[model samples]
Target: MAYLQQAPAWFLWLASLGALYVSAFLPRLLVYLTHCLRRPEDLRLRYGTWAVVTGPTSGIGRSVALELARRGLNLVLVDLDAANLHEVSGTIMSRHAVQTMAVVFDLSLVSTRKGDEALRRLRDAVKKLDVGILVNNAGIAKPGAVFLHEADVEAWVRMIRVNLWAVTEVTAAVLPGMLRRGRGAIVNMGSASSEGINSFPLHTMYSATKRYVAQFSRSLYVEYKSKGIDVQCQAPFFVSTTMASGFAAAWRSSALVPTADTYARAAVGWIGKGSPLCVPNLRHRLLGWYLAAVPGGVQDWFCLRENLRHRKMLRSARSPRASACRPHGHGIPSIE
Candidate 1:
């Protein structure tokens, strides 16, 4: 008691430091112990079964389909563009020699009644295959100013239908089989904008839809983790795809834009790891970290200014008779 009472300040400081060290290491030690006690399946490869990839005609979706085919997984490719669908499917079949099925349907057009019909068709088509992977990669976005005065409500509704509703519909169609099989993986293609941004003024509806996808994936993971299902929300930065060519050239220099193949490869790697959220590229990871750590008001101020500048650049790119920038020598296709 006397020794304790008379202990030097430096001695107390040293003791405190030792305690902190133990506290820091204890969690890791416990985790290691728990891991050792868990079943081998907990650490084994969870990918490589029958897979479905939406929007598998171009960009990231096509890349993912190719990568999965290379891994020896049979694929079901979904897309609205029948011509591109045929092109991509033919390429994958000839290159990989994997069994491939192509389905052409506008998921955005399927309502509750139509969704039932679509789901029935999808179910009937894949009923024979042991599907273990679902890539919800279909989405649409319209480029414009953010404010209601400039925003197109019809376009916003269409974007929401394609980006959000289709994900729900497809997942609902495939989840039951996965649950019964006791093993599966679902990867939802999200956007970096889902975390909320003050800088990009025109993506209000797009960002909101992406946020919904992220949240939905998280909730589904929590709900189905015990059933041997892994859900991953992949949020990637600007890619050199036609969809983002204008934005990439305006916001980030061409040197910084990642190609669709790069993003797809990284996303597959993350899926293999059973990661809950995959953010490709170090720059995007750092940006997410900083945005989450910064004060809301300060982030908003910076974001608003950046968004205004970005809007101006997009407007300039949209000038009549202006030539649309091409990436990878592929001219942008007219959707209309």
Candidate 2:
């Protein structure tokens, strides 16, 4: 009693703050445990049997399609790459014995006349099917990790179109069926650059578009929750996809970077569950928390430094004089 009464004002305030922080943290930790340990919702039963995955030819999109197929969901596989899309469709059908329909559509041109025709076709194809899951996973980051001034401005335009407009238009096309059926799940792929850190120096436009995705999903979740629709944004830090392979090699020597298949497995468990904004992988959750606690300026510094280094390596590889560096990475910028 005497010791407590004698506590200084600053000490009391600090103690109260610490207690409040823990009070909030514990419940969240419990929720995460429940989400991770619980049985995943059955897609075919809860949502419908048909899952539509954009950018389904590779990376996170491809893996998610396969996982859904494994769970006995037929798929509407969409991508700009005709050959790879067909191959993936065939693979899923053969291995999982699930049906797959591949659509070769360019998302970057979603607002154009050509995109209208493609989207109309997409709508017509899926309108009759039971599309319970929609993964808005098609995305691109062309001329990546360069300064705003140094990047090709058209590349930025294309990125915005693919990342933003495509997501919006596609959702619009699919939402009607979900509304009629009164059940569906929409998973929007996001990045930790937008969700965890306040700034992404070298990858400005990419992060901005992803930030939009996170907010878009959160808002849509709120809007559609009572309507029997699940809108979730999955913000991942880094996966072993070719998109992250170059810079991730320098970040923890890629030890922390999960493979697409590994991430996909974890991600599916989180679908239509928990907060609309979710960090799926356990490692990425830790990293996001750590990065969130760090000073914003420090985060800016580290992001800029690593991104700058990655950009330099990218340029060197492209330079005619530096022929030793490998030229292409498969599965990056799925739209282009």
Candidate 3:
């Protein structure tokens, strides 16, 4: 009592502020570390017997499908490419000995009745299964960076349709069943572009769409978490796939730029854990933590400069002079 009475006011204020900071940040840090230490549970028991993965033919989607199969869950593989979907289904079945079904539906056409029809088909395909997980992984970004006014209107619209609308529509279609079953998980693929304080200048629409996913996922989490549903939006950067090949050539294989398979192996362990908004890739999450320390304006400028450099390099590579330098047997890589 005597020591407390003699304590300095400034020291008490500082101690209070320190406690306030810890109260705000410590729980999240503990959750993240817990998610890191434990592997995801058995999907068949945790959610259900089946999991659906959209855009399952390639990239992270394909890897997620395979990883889910490895965990002994039947799969419903959805993609626009029927041939590719079939191949992925066959591979998963043969490798994991799990039943697999492929649903070919184009998410980019959601603005029209075409997308509606595709969703109908997807619903019908999964109507008989005990689907417990939906991975909204199908999304697209244009080839080269451009200002909003100069961008391809049709492509930009398609990007919005696929990245934003599809997520909403798909979740709506799938959520009722999850609610009925009393257990389910929805994993929306967001981007690190809008994670934390980073702002992508030239990639405006894509960033906006991802921001929508993050918000939607968090809101849905609050709404349905008590009903035995897990909705999460994971933001990852520079995944080494056809979609990101335009950003950096070395993205082919690097610790910072993980291949889809490698990223998925780590990401799957986080499926039904952590905050509704997640950065699944460990390296990318660490980078996000580092970037959080920098001033917001500086982060924006760095992203803007990087995007500009990438756009210039892409333009040069597509120019006639650079095209002529290619070897006879070589061809430009598909940027997806």
Candidate 4:
């Protein structure tokens, strides 16, 4: 009876501790659980399939291509780098003994009338194959501080062309066949910035393009998920590929930096499990959850502060000599 009477004080303290622990660890635990429950059977590929992987010359795209080839899928490797595309195709064919076709065209420029013609040619090339998978991984990021008047206008347009426009075009090109066959998988490579507008500084254009990807993926998932077409959007954080090595090295955090191969494996694994959106690294997954739970105003403030900090760091890193000697010519944005 005495113990019961005194229990309220102890119980309150224990409850407070429980709440704190949950606040800190529940999201991570849930993400881990979600991954655990996701089985390969939930998202299995039919044997002897054909897949089209864009930007297969390097980075995550190359890793994805190798993964698909290893899974016994015939591949159509698409990239602007003809030499690298041929080399990669040859390597995959010799190593995996899988049929591979190389399609060399700049997907980023596939917007003009000539670009449309090129897309038609590429489409025709793949039309003969039994393409069951479409991996829209081609993307580009411009190096700039912000989407302001100082930024290169053409660079912004090119970023949109590669990151957003190409994804839409390729997905549309592959849709009819997938719908007709009543079985296909489309994995769009989104980024962590898509969840929030101000996820990174100097990434304004890239972030906006990714936001489009996230929205498009959600809408398509709702419209076609029941039609036997699996549409997934993978929003991964920084991977230690050449594409992101500079950023990763500047930050120098291994836990936050996953390798391209690790990212590819987790992404492909989740695709096989039919996950609509996959964020691989545990820390990023938690950050995403926290960002989701927070208010929009708070997120905006956070982003603004982060941008200011990045700007300060960037200013400190630039030397007067290098700044004076920097080239004035406009350069095209490239994902690789």
Ranking by TM-score: 2, 3, 4, 1
Candidate order by decreasing lDDT: 2, 3, 4, 1
Please write out the lDDT profile of model 3 over residues 120-216, one tens digit for every residue.
Answer: 9877877777999999999887734777888768888888888999899888888878888999999999988778646877778888999999999
Give the TM-scores of the predictions, in the order they appear.
Answer: 0.77, 0.89, 0.88, 0.81
Better of 1 and 4 by lDDT: 4
Q: Candidate 2 residues 1-336, lDDT tens each?
A: 799789999999988877876787678778888889987677789999898999988889899999988999999988888999879988998899788888888998888999899999899988999999999998886656677998777889899999998999999899999999999999999888788887988778888999999999999999999999999999998887767654523453466789999999998888988889998898888777656657899887887888788777767666666655445553222212
Please write out the lDDT profile of model 1 over residues 104-191, one tens digit for every residue.
7688776757656766778777777788899999887664445546766777777888899889988988888888888889999998
Off by over 4 Å in 3: 1-30, 248-253
Query: Which of candidates 3 and 4 reaches a greater TM-score?
Result: 3
In model 4, what are the clashing residue pairs, if there are any? Answer: none
Among all candidates shown, the one with the greatest TM-score: 2
lDDT of each: 0.73, 0.85, 0.83, 0.73
Relative to the unseen true structure, what is the C-alpha lDDT of residue 297 in candidate 3, on a scale of 0 to 100? 89
- The alpha-carbon deviation from the true structure for residue 101 of candidate 4, after best TM-score superposition, in angstroms, is 0.9
CA error at residue 206 for candidate 3, angstroms: 1.0
Runs in model 1 lying further than 4 Å from the true structure: 1-48, 112-116, 196-200, 246-250, 254-256, 272-275, 290-295, 316-336
How much does candidate 3 score in TM-score?
0.88
Q: What lDDT is reached at residue 96 by model 4?
A: 95
